[model samples]
Target: MQVTQNIKAPEMLIDYYKAIEDSSARMLEAAKHHDWDEVVRCEGACAVLIEQLRYRSQDQELPPEQRKEKTRIMQRILRNDAQIRILAEPWLAQFDHPFEGKPQVLH
Candidate 1:
């Protein structure tokens, strides 16, 4: 008898991507409510997850069977990022406007 693995690829990648999607969704909700702080916090969390995913991916490649699922997840992430950027544009413009007339300060 031969032992076989059930996972097509390292499931950790899927889990990490899912976690990022969940955080992106949360950020979208917070942005909808104009909760900029919470959105920032969630964005921070997403960044950390992204770093971990990158590190993990450096050592593991997704199997052919799992590539399709990864592509779908990536699409969803892109859509979420787009929506979040749309929601944040006005808030970002507001911040920019306040500094438009100020002299640039060199640190």
Candidate 2:
């Protein structure tokens, strides 16, 4: 017999925040390894989670305890993002002017 596992969607706004925090952490890890593709993939996941969070937030509010947790999650996510940016600056600089000294017009 084969068994299937069901995954559940986050039911609270704070849950979405947690998911975004998780994605940011993954992105930071990928940046540490210089895995640009994985970083981009995790970033996409964060974007989707952020959009979902915005929609759900319109109808739901976090409890006091969850709000405190959400604040912590947001702080951690921000720190991860800052580190990722620091790691990416050099990598991103390479594309700043790929056509330097090349002809302005192709012919």
Candidate 3:
């Protein structure tokens, strides 16, 4: 089999992108309605999905400074979330990408 066969199809990847866009839209909806809780929930869910999307680094070897940066990020991977969504909301909105889901509480 060719290596490309194991790779994800472009549309599947685009759907994932659209899901994220919809997720952002959901946040925008929540914000428009002044629903901070829903904003927090939707943004956090999208962040979790992005983390899951990361593939293993092909370049396993890193220079010393880069290694330290990677170590810091890896350490954060274990830390409990500390209400990061609050800070994240305005910043994400400033980027102006459209997301599309009707706002609803998932948990």
| TM-score (all chains, Cα) for each model | 0.77, 0.85, 0.41
The candidates, ranked best first by TM-score, are: 2, 1, 3
lDDT (tens digit, per residue) of candidate 1 on 7-107: 12225677777778778777877888888888888888888888888999999877788788888888988888899899999989978678787798989
Q: What is the lDDT ranking, best to worst? A: 2, 1, 3
Runs with alpha carbons beyond 4 Å of true place in candidate 1: 1-11, 99-107
- Model 3 TM: 0.41
lDDT of 2 by residue, 1-107 (tens): 11122223778888888788888888888899898888888888889889998999888888887878888899999999999999999999889987877878866
lDDT for every model?
0.77, 0.83, 0.49
lDDT tens readout by residue for model 3, 1-98:
11111122223333333444455656655656666677677677667545544432232334455555545544443231233355456767856855
User: Which candidate's TM-score is highest?
Assistant: 2
Better of 1 and 3 by lDDT: 1
Residue pairs whose backbone atoms clash in candidate 2: none
Task: Please give the distance, in angstroms, between residue 40's alpha carbon in candidate 3 and its true position after superposition.
Answer: 0.3
Cα deviation in Å at residue 107, candidate 3?
38
Where does candidate 1 clash, by residue pair? none
Worst 10 residues of 1 by lDDT: 1-10
Q: Mark the regions of model 3 whose C-alpha exceeds 4 Å error after superposition.
A: 1-11, 56-107
